[model samples]
Target: MNEERAASEQEAVENDVVARVLASFENTPDARLRLVMTSLVRHLHAFLREVRLTETEWESAIAFLTAAGHITDDRRQEFILLSDVLGASMQTVAINNPVSGGATQATVFGPFFVDDAPHVERGGDIALGAVGEPAWVEGVVTDLRGDPVPGARIEVWEADEDGRYDVQYADARVGGRGYLYSGIDGRYAFWGLTPTPYPIPFDGPVGDLLTATARSPYRAPHLHFMVSAPGLRTLITHIFVRGGEYLDSDSVFGVKESLITDFVVQDAGTPTPDGRELGGRTWSRARFDIVLADSE
Candidate 1:
């Protein structure tokens, strides 16, 4: 709430309304939760006053949120989708992950992440029959100073050439996503579908909101990565295809210059890092060495 202006009696009543709501949280058990609630109330009330929100509009907002809740299930999360499109997800990530010692910058963690992704061995294929050209993804996990941080768990996922994640389908098949650990040398590798530009799931309330506001639902072509190791900040980020479409207008606004990287094309039968042949089929490869900051 703005603390100072020409105070009026009606405005005093309004300010008192805010004060009373804030006072309600005085007995909250958790200090952090109390502070967060207090801040939220202040902002929310300020918005209501600034916009002079109507009762009908408030009811509409409630209906929208109720629809979001109804659409959210074990495999789909409409609220995270809402947060992504609103830039809330990225804002939270930025606040928690400042530029520290040149560590890889964080970005939005999309709604599609799963708790127990299948494991992939070093240089093993994670595509699991998803459609797209084969690509080799290799990276090293390290500290800000570049020392190897072995045993870092690297979780990865992406959509297929047709721009659909596995979970978007009826079967919820686990393709195009998996996890692997860094080696003693801090190196990890896996095979995945080369990413393509794709839309966020657009059949829910988020989609209706975007349509009503003239927004595009497409995200830039990218592969998701979440790397974690003891004593280092866990990083949720994506490596976008350097020249992929929709880079400038990603629906979720997750593109970062430092995270855009090359997906170098390879000739059929090109010798892979592990010396595997592609049976005369062309492939692509990318290298993304990651750096982690010390945990806060």
Candidate 2:
């Protein structure tokens, strides 16, 4: 066929695909869902058109997606990792979470948060048997105006000094089930060895995709959180360690300037109820206030 004819045929195919997709959403009960799906299909097709994507490349992408799903299990979430690396997770947060003046910014929750983490008291150690620089994290959950949000619930999780989460280990008792929940007055504190920056899981298909794209896999050292209250929108965010090597180059593209905190090194001379003395030891401290939006 002539070049013009081939181009016309391609346009027809694209139009037909768009029509079918849009038609299927015509009766959608949810207005927001219909609008989002319609826009997604439009942009997706436009992207393919602009890139002049090949059949081989498209098939490869399909296979990659299939492999990502196949690798998911109760403990592993490949799709979230895929979204994170591709910046979709960040985009979703941006679109859904608009900052209200002084409200704390929202961020990606990451794929590692497990449900029902073991609850521990304030100042309890989440790093059970891990050896590294001790760190103290304390903060209050409040509104943009700095008013304390009493009874707010904040859940926390993070990797150990080795840059590994608890669920990643076969030995569940080791650093697994990290601390969760907040105390009275929306105050929460925990003790853990400082975590090191590490790469996301790279032994799987997601890794292969990143390798193919020449993208780095290192995420900045940070703690994960899910903060919520009775009358506010829940927040899923990370508190990045200041001065961490990967701060400016998070592999998952999840880091934000507002999220970075100075993990100050404290002397070991400080006394603790656990009988652990803060003598000449170094520790990191990050204090971030969570501001929740009033629920409608």
Candidate 3:
């Protein structure tokens, strides 16, 4: 009788799971969402059945998730990293962006973005207050047809030479705290030190997972960009530095072919805009245009 009762309870739990999963779609207003949810539920259940996942494994996953949550703070976004490494973030972007022929390819936004960075004028130096090799990044926002989209806003951010974002360190002694707004012609330029490849924080559970998987925690050198304007879809992407190690193996799997750009080193003898002799050191320059999709 006890064995029979156990079987009945297990069956009841399974049925409840199915019912609840199906019921979630009843109030979904969007037909697409309803369909997606239904399919997701079916596949999820199928996966469980296929795996025959043990309760111990489920408990371990829950514990890992709990640790991931516990490691998150204002500046550290382990959950975002978790989503990134899992490819869920990129998958969502791909689904939403849906290659429209000429639209810019969307990628992960990463976890280090900070709102309301101190804005600077066009061609201004974002790394002025910091230290590193000087670099000038200039670009225009255009449609796929190469027509400039004037007044498009290009929000940019990057890590310092030390591979740490401004918010990552509380000392304020590290660099990387600059923001630049593009001009009316969709032209934007800013000066900063070249960003270097760095390892993601490995003190958390996600890091532990990566370590267990024998994956390196280093990201390729890249600059983050978010371009948007009225009547255009926003683009969240990165311009990876060409020839940088880790391009083929980004820790978070955020690299894309179209986004890889060469960082040209200009001769130090070049004339400066202010008539000052250009510093006698090689500097990197990357220029890429962003194409935005038309908002339907």
Query: TM-score for all predictions?
Result: 0.94, 0.89, 0.86
* Residue 98 accuracy (lDDT) in model 1: 92
Query: What are the lDDT figures for the candidates, one per model?
Result: 0.93, 0.80, 0.81
Better of 2 and 3 by TM-score: 2
Query: Which model is ahead, 1 or 2, in terms of lDDT?
Result: 1
Model 1: per-residue lDDT, tens digit, 1-296?
A: 34455457668989999999999999999999999999999999999999989999999999999999999998899999999999999899999999897899899999888887899998988899999999999989999888999999999998889998888889868899999999999999999988999899999899999999999999999999999999999999999999999999999989999999999999888888888777788899999999999998
Ranking by lDDT, best first? 1, 3, 2
Q: How well does candidate 1 match the true structure in TM-score terms?
A: 0.94
Measured by TM-score, how close is model 3 to the native structure?
Answer: 0.86
Candidate 2 matches the true fold with a TM-score of 0.89
- Cα RMSD to the true fold for all candidates: 3.3, 2.5, 3.6
Ranking by TM-score: 1, 2, 3
Q: On a 0 to 100 scale, what is the lDDT of residue 1 in model 3? A: 62
Best by lDDT: 1
